[model samples]
Target chain A: MHIIEVTQLQKHFGDFKAVKGIDFFVEQDEVFGFLGPNGAGKTTTINMLTGLARPTAGTIQIAGHDGIREIKKVQRIIGIVPDESNLYDDMSGYENLVFCASLYGIKKQEREKRARQLLKQFTLDDTGSRPFKAYSKGMKRKLTIAAGIIHNPTILFLDEPTTGIDVESARQIRTMIRSLNNQGTTIFLTTHYIEDAERLCDRIGFIVEGRIIKVEETQSLLQEAQREHIVEFKVEHLDEGVIQEFLQSFNQIQVPRISDQTIRISSGRPIELMPYMEFLTSHNSKVLEAKLVHPSLEEVFVHITGVEIDRLKKEKEGKK
Target chain B: MNYRLMAYGNILKKDMQNYYLKPPNLSWGIIFPISWTLMFFLRSGSDVDIKAILPGVMALSILFGTTSMLSVTITFERKSRSFERLLLSPISLNLLMLAKTTGAIIFGIINAFIPVLFASFFVDLGGIQWTLLFSGVVLIAVTSTFLGLFIAVSVNEVFEAQTFSNFFRFPMVFLCGLFIPLEQLPRVLRPLSYLFPLTYGADILKFSVNHQASINRIVSFAILLLYAVGLFLVSTHNIKKRWIY
Candidate 1:
């Protein structure tokens, strides 16, 4: 069963179309990543799904209820951890959690118990009495996530949960996310962190310019990248002219370049490394190391999105 | 309905604990009114009727406390994005507004009563009718709170909310018969005074203190109730329209 189903979901902000008719569904207990650059409508889509923003056009069904008409039903089943840690600043961490629980209609005693459990689980037990505004960025993020799950929601929407935090805290949050998925909660996460998506998402949808360019299983997407084979050879006393001449002789090899005694070759098909090694050795060059380089998820994303990962990363940082 | 009520209670409790209980807010709501009443007593010559002005002081307290507190609380939450959490909850919007307005109303009533309590030490309270006074205070508090909600939801920033509140509040203070008798006002401004909810509250209080109401008690109650309901609907509608993106 799909926990979230969005069809032709669109959102327009005045003259700009933020999310232009995107469609996707997240299966039950799946960690679905929505990947995009800044201002690419990833947040707009999440807002529509979570009922924080009205869709200009399209339909959304969350856990068997119409996302618009039956929003209360959807709200009861879904927990949203917004990109901002927006709990009441004046309230203590424990108070924020209990308040969130109370909003979900948890009984007073149960709210207290659940709040305590979440604070401990988030490694915030010692700081539960501290006002939220006094918390460090990492602590606030942890507390926000804890509050999101205070009622044990069936589905959790985490928007850039690991962004702008200490490395240790980000790792801890990732572990918590994996654990939550293991406990049968459907996770819909939107992030600019390619590694987080590659590691946590069962499947990822690449969105660019308010459109989903592709959605595929993580492994499948990586496997599809195998169409291009890259082999890098390090040679002692390398002669660039001779290597270029030899590489030029093979029409199948494309974009071969020598940099600092290392010859990199790209081919549509897997190259026979034995012939390349023999060619280098015969040319008064000693082959030191040769290794095949498999494309990373970051590479696959760059290739699919037609944008450099660094450029996108810069854009995300600039937005922050 | 019950779940919504639970959400309302939770919101009200949280607001009270976080915003209303703060020292600055406490002083503004309670101490400010008492201080203002004392100022009035000090300035009043022997010819001034202290008993006649008591209700007006109480009405002013409700006005200032309810409008300022609600505006500040809403603006703070909205700026911090904490208010978004309330919107994301399963509770009905109406219930959320009710909870917020009701919190302000409770604080406003307490604010109004504090001055009265202080006044009783210096002024005789025997002539006042307790039932009429209580009812009028409740109605005024509710109306003022609803107005505060309307202003808060309409504006985006704390300063804007306060400015808008003042735009409404200062005019009401001058025209609501709080200081000047309604009949003493010029013919043109008399109708304008009736437009302010504070006018009815002042009228009710004047009658309660003097034991002779110029306006029928039933009529005053009904008009104030109507104002409360109308303002409540407008504020809730504005919240729904403006809150979501």
Candidate 2:
């Protein structure tokens, strides 16, 4: 079932159109990731869905309730972890969770119990009543996540969930997200952590310039990005003409390269790889070593987007 | 929990927490009000009774506590970025402003009156009316607190709140006869004093304890109450605009 349905939503900041009539739906208990370059209106769209930013035109429904008309109900049903948002500075980490819980009209005794349990789950314990101002960035992020999920909403919307944390902290956060997803909570996360998305998200929507370029299951998207592969192999020697005869066994094979007594064979499959290696071995071709490489998500992203993500990130940072 | 009451009580607790957290500031705040009350008692001792200065000293402390320390508190919150977090909470903008303002009133009352009661034991007032004096203290504290809240909302920054707060703050004390007698004011400025809510607050205080009731004294108290309500409405409007958009 679609828990969040957004259609023809448009938001224009003065003359600049931040979101231009985009459409998408997040389904039940599925981990969905939104991938995009920095200026791609990912935040603008997410803010609209979270009711922080009102759309100029369109309809967004959260569990069959109008997001604009019934914003309070929409807010109640979705827990949002906004990028770079602040926790209450004067309160302790435990107090921060209690404050958010009180906003939902939760009883204090229940809130205190839940807060203590969440603190243990995050492996966090404050020395005393240390204010949030004194907390490390990772601790603050963890506290915010605990606060967001305290009410146990049907859907969780996380934006750039691991932006500035250390690698160890990021991994811990990823593990926590996986646990949340396992418990039947629909996770709709937008992130620059492509590796996490590729590893954890069941489906991903590549958003760019206020549009969803492609939305597919992660494995299918990777397969679609790389239909054909060029395999490179090295051997001690090769007979060039006979290799052509051996290549005819497959649907497609490139002529082998023999340079400095090393033979390199190009093919789509490693199974096809064994056959070529066999032929070269029987022909008195001295086989030294072979390794198979699958195309990575970074490479796949570059192929589909036609631009390097690292360079794009640099340019966006420079502009900022 | 009654969420509204919880919010109000929590806000009050935070201020008390803030107050007790820094012992030096608390000590200084207590001393500042006490010293002012004593200085006024000594300076105007011969010319007028201690009762006249009784009102002066109380109004003096209320003025300084509400205008100076309260402004600094808001500015401190702004500088620390704590104010933004308050804005994001589900509490309405009006309650947030009310919480802070009401907190100031509580502090102002303690800073203004405790010294007066303590000093009253030192000097005896013959046939003085204690009932009217207490009522006057209530009115003056209310007006002073609302004035501070108005300044916090009107100023663009916390620093600006301090600068502009003094523009109205210092004059209200003098016009209300905290130092120079209201009768000694140039005839022209006396009428101007009538325009100030503090003038009525000061006189109602003087008449209630000293048995010097005038028809004009009653009118000033009514006007002072109106000032309190007006400032509240304006501050609430400003906070509402901040949240809605």
Using TM-score, give the best candidate's number.
1
The best candidate in terms of lDDT: 1
Q: Point out where model 2 deviates above 4 Å.
A: A6-24, A32-60, A63-80, A88-91, A126-131, A200-223, A227-308, A315-320, B19-21, B38-49, B67-85, B125-147, B153-157, B175-226
RMSD after Cα superposition, model 2: 9.3
Model 2 DockQ class: incorrect
Error of 1 at B231 (Å): 1.8
List model 1 lDDT by residue over A1-320, tens digit each.
98888899899989999999998999999999998877789988988888788899999999889999999899999999999998998889999999999988888899999999988888999999999999999999999999999989999999999888889999999999999999999999998788899899999999999999999999998887777788878889766688667767665675434556777666778778998898888888889999987766876777677665447668668645
**Residue A202 alpha-carbon offset, candidate 1, angstroms:** 0.6
DockQ of each: 0.59, 0.13
* Model 2 lDDT tens row, B1-245: 77656766676667667653357656765787678766765776755466656666677777777666666776667555455445544456577677777767767777766666666677775566667776777777778877777677666577798889889877777776656677788888888777777777877766765565443766877888898888788766765443232
> What RMSD does each model have against the real structure?
5.9, 9.3
**TM per candidate, chain B:** 0.94, 0.86
Model 2 pairs in collision: B129-B209
- What's the C-alpha lDDT at position A8 in model 2? 94
